[model samples]
Target: MPSFLRWIACRAMLAACLAGIAASARAGCEPLTEDGHDYVACRFDPRSDALSLYWRGADGMPLATTERLADAVAATGRKLVFAMNAGMYDTALAPIGLYVENGRMLHRANLRNGAGNFHLKPNGVFYFGDGKAGVMETGRFLKARLNPAFATQSGPMLVIDGQIHPKLQPDGASEKVRNGVGVRDDGTVVFAISTEPVSFYAFARLFRDRLGTQNALFLDGSISTLYAPPLPPVGGWRSLGPMLGVTAGP
Candidate 1:
């Protein structure tokens, strides 16, 4: 075989190996700082793990904690490997917008013109089904009619089509511990939470520039929470609204 041909084959093999690693990336959450702000991020491939959304459990009450969610998952012969507050909620712990779990649309998409980050124009949804997942602007999602098995709606998209949300200012004053989710070009889902108060601009940049996601949505702020065993726990409120998580076989 020609030397050039052998080199091409080696490069292809290396690409394949890298893809496999990304496809099964559940090693742990990573902590890092970008532009003077600190954050912890985790990546997972929906195609490889059974990613689902949860609200009320078998007892007809919300599973309000990681331990409870874990128990619920264990009941089905699975282990809760990852969990995160998926969206903003009202006073009664109800999703402010669309919330679909296990193919049931509990809360239809809230299209009313209102206030808060959730009502911010261009809010988006994070949804997945079968072997694929995506983050898309709510309008686009509604038009697409993807009908994902599990979906959660949140506001003020961080990044769209590789560009940061137009309204987020680079030096915006408001800042708080925040978390959001994004979908990579390869269909990998990335979740990130700022370790400290960070402006919406920086957070959006974290997803667009650092994470390389074409579309990303801001899940929540201040009450942003995550529960990946590999990393430390984070929950601003006693209980969260819609929860998104991954499960591993028991």
Candidate 2:
């Protein structure tokens, strides 16, 4: 099919998936397309879905892989239905920026200027608590002075206040499998991963345009991975830093 045709078809699919979706949403993924790029979006609500973040296991080591996380949660009589790499990490697999899990601040916000995607100015944080979620630029988030139950800091925000990152090119040459998160106006959290390699601008637009999120944060590239099965590999992921997922009790 022509690229435009495919894009149209995928938009229709996304609309159908979102129709009637609310706090009742389950951990299910749907195919989406934006400006000819293919993506898979999985949505859930912390109000009803067991949306949460994970880092260490019972043994106090990073749970690194989705497969391993699934095993660990299962042992606790829970079902892990959704997961994705949460943010960039160091060689030791520690989140490079602020990381809060279960209302506990495990790491502090990173404000030092440095190289790489994480240092992209206006990097933001995705946070949730009390059944509410939001995406905010790291600076603004700090000024807000609100503490959330769970939050992860990631770089080069895809969208801010409804605008794409000022630095990304609409048709940039760089392309790779990418994933990110956004919060819809209704406080519903959406996680997405590009099915095919895509540019940063394209991926960012997927959240703002098609997904209707006011703000979005780029989680990672190439290493981006979504744990929605039956979907494609998404990308290679292991030794990942903080991770987010949805679970259900047995």
TM-scores for all predictions: 0.88, 0.88
Q: Number of clashes in model 1?
A: 0
Tens-digit lDDT string for candidate 1 (1-250): 9999999999999999866654454545788899999998888877777788988789988777777888999999977878889998887778988888888999999888887899888999999989899998998999997888888999999999999999999889999999999999999899999989999999999998998899999999998887877678876466877788887763
Deviation from native of the Cα of residue 136 in model 2, angstroms = 0.2
What are the per-residue Cα lDDT tens digits for candidate 2 across 14-37?
A: 887555342243456888777887
The whole-model C-alpha lDDT of candidate 1 against the native structure comes to 0.87
Give candidate 1's error at residue 154 in angstroms.
0.6
**On a 0 to 100 scale, what is the lDDT of residue 212 in model 1?**
86
Candidate 1 — worst ten consecutive residues by lDDT sum? Answer: 19-28
